[model samples]
Target: MTTVHGSSYRFIWFGLEMVSLFIHFTCLLPLLIGTPVTRAFMPRLNGATFLGPSNALSPVNVAHSRNRGIFCMRSNEMITVEGVSVVLLAGGVGKRMKADRPKQFIELLGKPVLLHSLEIFSTLPGVNRIVIVLDKSYRQEFSFLQEEDPRIVFADPGKERQDSVFNGFSQTLPDASVVCIHDSARPLVSQSAVLASLRDGSVHGAAVLGVPMKATVKESADGEFVLRTMNRSRLWEIQTPQVIKPDILSEAFALVTEKGLEVTDDVSMVEQVGRPVKLTMGEYTNIKLTTPEDIGVAEGFLRERAEGKL
Candidate 1:
């Protein structure tokens, strides 16, 4: 009985080896036959021509173009511009927070507010890079808590948000197609809103997140005098994660520099060049943490998200 079982096992092992060899040979056959035919048809073309070899259709040239096209197509398929590189503007003195530390660096749920903002971008699959624009004086403070993640890069904040964005732009990776500039104070920005802005910016040269005004907005000259009642429907409260193409952003900044404009956001800079920035719907919860009350609201928002309520 034992001898019969051993013989059966040996036979099965021999069958498996034969199947493996057949599969290996089948895979190699295509490479062996295709290489010679490809080489015979395709001749190498010079790189100087802007037009690919498909435009010039000799048999040899056609094969060459096909070969190159296959390789180029594979490469392009591999290249993806998923999430945009984010620039977080966090250089303010925090006069509203009234804290020695910048409002961004203030702790919420044991982590700094700025860190929370960065964590959101870091977790996003599309976000490949993050540039934090920090006050130069807080360089040491910012550096102390640095993580080893390659995606995170730091830049010194300029005197204004526009300047900080310029500094951040300078530090952005050359290959990055788009950039999203967000206010560090606004930590409640939703991923959906960010993604929406990116999509809008991709189609339209630029996009900014904004919420329509809920209350009647009035312009007044003094404490008691109301000058004009503005149309609330046309008005929107702008939020961050403002996205734009890298070249467009660069040009906008250059224009700002040339014109000596003191603009608050990249949208304004782009507008200076007569470029219309489209608006993506922004979440009402995405508020800039300027005053003390905002902190409580932010903490509650964070707690809710943590508890799976959001």
Candidate 2:
């Protein structure tokens, strides 16, 4: 492992500050280039060109552009480890799945989907605490959290997904600096993707997981006719365990509440504030359990992982 010298700490900080200031005023090249991992796929387009010549980003469009894979920033290497807090969201309505209970509570591989998601976060070394948001009625019935670890805790659900998430966020460990928000339906989020979100979120304020789109997308004004074929090159299928700095998460949520804006995901909350958000690549196998067909897919993915074929 590479060690940072005490004498050079100040220098690194100074360099980072200057870079942040420069990027804020002149160019977003630093973030566009991002870390070595992002460079593997992001094309070498001038950052100025990506956001246009305007120094400021348009708030409404920034999140949309970001979701399409524009934001990326390299993280610092020398900061002390301050264990991560994971806010796992398991409070979906599951209306699409037609289940007796929420999809997260439904059986998969002889285990609840929520438990499967919890087990993934448990495998990470830096994860110190997990605040799981469960359906109020189901929490009364489940035995999933019975075999307790000191790190495990539960929070009550809210009327909407965002409320449940913020409730979990408020319960994060006091010492935690990195906060990871994930969907319990996505039980297959990889350990590598979670780690990547942590590293990138540290520098970018927020980092999300997603996969590039492979199929063509079409636009339609009504259900029947296609308006046009949209560009697939700039699109990605977003996923979770979105890791973020606590302060950024707070600020983003505050903005959402103040403006009465509806947000679909955590990183979108950050993006709507006209701030940068990093995107880490996630495997397609990291699917969300939304419909009955998705259950079969999850089984196949789990079987593949078990057989070393994934």
Candidate 3:
């Protein structure tokens, strides 16, 4: 009996050793075979492919798992499958910007502000196409853009921001599973923030990129007097590239049409339908080109980025 017990222990130890060796082999196999490992990896989940680093996981990925329905937890970085489409909203006339053209048409860093955001999305993997929601009046000015990238297409702007998104969504291919909505005026969006928002959206049905409010808040019934002081801790200033599953966005839009509600942003549509949206942290440098003063700020940010200081 003593001999048999000793043999069993030895067998168990050998099995454990083999398991460790296999795990190590799997990790190093790409290097051993001289295959290049990309910055992103694709993981299969529930018949969908998720692109991200397979080795690391973040707590933020699991933050809404229980309460937000089905959540696919993965690393902070992720790309969707080849069916992702981006809607660049440039329909708004820059009344406040006081520019010669629309804010999006204004030049920043020697390129049009809209082009800066367009370049970012076009280069990302899994972004199959981008729909620029512009007025018919501006189409001739940007006609050369189509020659630059085959994935770009234009959609006519509607009366409101939500309408523009709806028009953009209609232009996406039938196979598109995910939709990313961004403001063309925000020319400084980083690749990291876009990826994080995409991953969060894929996992939690919807996601919005934003930064927490830095200043104390006040609520006013009238412009001159304050009604109450708002809670600064819970306040967040939202930014774009808001991402969502097409089905969820479609449902949100359906509700919007049924109720005739005017929405300021895309994620608010999900909220109206009682859906939760994950908030991904975005940089303060991703500012919208709202007024003339913002141009100087953007130029400085661009300089910092070029010098590797950002």
Candidate 4:
């Protein structure tokens, strides 16, 4: 009985050794054959397909092919997907705020209001580039912000908001696909609103953000008398992050320049060209900080967001 038990133990040990050998072979097989498989599947290397050492198939030669598929997929997807460009108009003088600093440069919480506006666009996955129109004297300040994110570019501001937007668009003319014009004073612009405008522009050529007016609007010839009461339903308070295709926007701006027309926003320029601009509903809390009172409102909004009330 002892001899029979020893023979059974030897047989079990041999079986275990064979299983270990099989597992090791299975693990090494991929390393051995990965290069041939990758070379066979990869497209020819040329100027367009050259990915250098960071290329997906490079891993086949380096024994770390785990992220190869991801690299390849991203490269292919980026080639076809058009990205949106954003133009932030930061040239306003901030006369209403009664501050020495421009409204965009004013400190909100701890950071500058303009920095917060740029951060919102910087965080978005679809935003490819950002152009900031600033006062010529503040070029140094904008340069510091550009250093923080290379995606940000600077433009010389014009006398009016329309001119500032035109200058920003001109700077981005060569590369921008869809251009989104936003006010730097409106720090509460959300990712949803930006994405919504981008998508609408992609489909319909132009779009703008606006909130339906709640108060009764009136036209008055004198301080004491109201000439007419306007329908609130037809009235909307316009906001920023207005998006349009680059070519359409360029044409519209050209028309406005030819006609010697001064408009408030890019949407008006597009409208002057007879292009229909779609409206996306914007949040009431997305207010532009025009006065000192608005700063308190912004602080309250920030506190609410911190407390999970937004």
Per-prediction TM-score to the true structure, in the order listed = 0.71, 0.72, 0.77, 0.73
Please give the CA lDDT of all the candidate structures: 0.74, 0.75, 0.82, 0.75
> Residues 200-270, candidate 2, lDDT per residue (tens digit)?
67667788888889999999999799999989999999999888888888898999999998878888888
Which is the better candidate, 1 or 3, if ranked by TM-score?
A: 3
For residues 186-290, could you state the per-residue lDDT of candidate 1 as single tens digits? 899877576567656766789899888898989998969899999999999888989999989988988888989899778999899988898778888899998
Model 4's alpha-carbon lDDT is 0.75
Give, for candidate 3, the lowest lDDT window spanning 10 residues: 61-70
**Model 2, residue 7: what's the lDDT?**
77
lDDT by residue for model 4 over 179-256, one digit each (tens)? 888998998876656655665566679988888899989999887899999988899999988989988998998898
Candidate 4: 10-residue stretch with minimal lDDT: 56-65
Could you report the Cα RMSD, in angstroms, for every candidate shown? 14.6, 16.5, 7.9, 11.7
RMSD of 4: 11.7
| Higher-scoring candidate on lDDT, 2 or 3 | 3
State in Å the error of residue 25, model 4. 38
Regarding TM-score, does 3 or 4 come out ahead?
A: 3
**What count of clashes does model 4 give?**
0
